[model samples]
Target: MDQAVLPLSPTEQETSLGSIVPPHTADAYWLTPYGAPGAWSTNTTYIVGHSWEGRASPFNNISSLSQPGDVLTVTTAEGPVHYKIDRVTTEYKDTLKDSAIWDKAPGRLVLITCFMEDLGGKNIIIQASPLPAA
Candidate 1:
């Protein structure tokens, strides 16, 4: 919960080539060019990181976010934004871009990481929506 969210921007070359890879770091990365967290925009904000085996990383815990009502918060410069887990599903690495997680939605969040158990085959995707203020 105390993790940092670093901005990740694809290089112009990578962007032009249509290839983008998240950096190899333990911190969560906010995919730039999309709506930032807590924004009232028309794009889904994506936070991605690696899930390593035998290592205690925050992203490794993403696989446990299976319950629909679970909540997680992302702290931005403005403040904290809360999201409620809508669904958690996995997609093949080859077909991930075409998955439902890429849908354009206002105030939606999608956390992505490699599925450790099936590291080479699929990716773990945790989709959530902004939680209303109490």
Candidate 2:
């Protein structure tokens, strides 16, 4: 006989914004760690920042998403991994260095989404240090 698969509990279902992706999106193309499942499916990401009023919106604007402290786990082209969170602020959308968040840094993880509000709006950014080796 085949066993049944139960759904994840509410607490288990909760995940960070960086890990959550739009529904129906293909996971293979996502900028997440290889070998590991997608962040949204695994719920490995955690929420570090929140709106000033502490309100949580599932689909918040980019500005509202970048509160500070958000985190993300990512896979590098070299196959290494890293994490990052907001450490500094620059011009909203016009900034060029924003992409630097993904570059190899001392940290092992970096979180990026959107920020501010503009034609394309700003992106939420995060930079996280890697966890110690097991």
Candidate 3:
């Protein structure tokens, strides 16, 4: 797809992982399907994208180069919200739920993407807490 990831709300009954978490296109980033944005609450905001091999994807940096202290800003209709990285790790794709990154606790940003060129082989997770007052 040529379109980029856009931030939009999902349907109330949107529980299918396919529908809730659309396949990442070359141009777009997908926000979490359930949680409200960090601006709305201390709640977590999840985002997933693909690390398109040899291509420019929105999350390529996060997948390949991000560190524990790096900063990321996500701009929503509410405005720009800042997040300070707290953790970065790699996990096998199938066991993502077993990781602490799935916590429903407040005040978190989870950036998930394919590890290297393998979409299902591995995943790199970046967890961050919302910076004080974006």
Off by over 4 Å in 3: 1-4, 8-21
Report the candidate with higher lDDT, 1 versus 3.
1
Per-model TM values vs. the true structure: 0.87, 0.34, 0.76
Order the candidates by TM-score, highest first. Answer: 1, 3, 2
RMSD (Cα, Å) for all candidates, in order, is 2.1, 12.6, 3.9
Off by over 4 Å in 1: 12-19
Please give, for residues 20-69, the per-residue lDDT of candidate 2 as tens digits: 33232111122333113222223333222221223433223434444456
Model 2: residue 40 alpha-carbon error in angstroms: 22
TM-score of 3: 0.76
lDDT of 3 by residue, 1-134 (tens): 13334664655554333234445575454554546556556557777667777788766756557777788876667777788888888888666656666567686777777777676688888888788882
Model 2 misplacement above 4 A: 1-29, 32-91, 97-99, 116-119
lDDT of each: 0.79, 0.34, 0.66
Q: 1 or 3: which has the higher TM-score?
A: 1
| lDDT winner between candidates 1 and 2 | 1
What is the per-residue lDDT of model 1 for residues 1-134, given as tens digits with 9 covering 90 to 100? 46788889978885455335688667788889777888475789988888778877778867774667898888776778889988888888877756767668989998888898886778888888998755
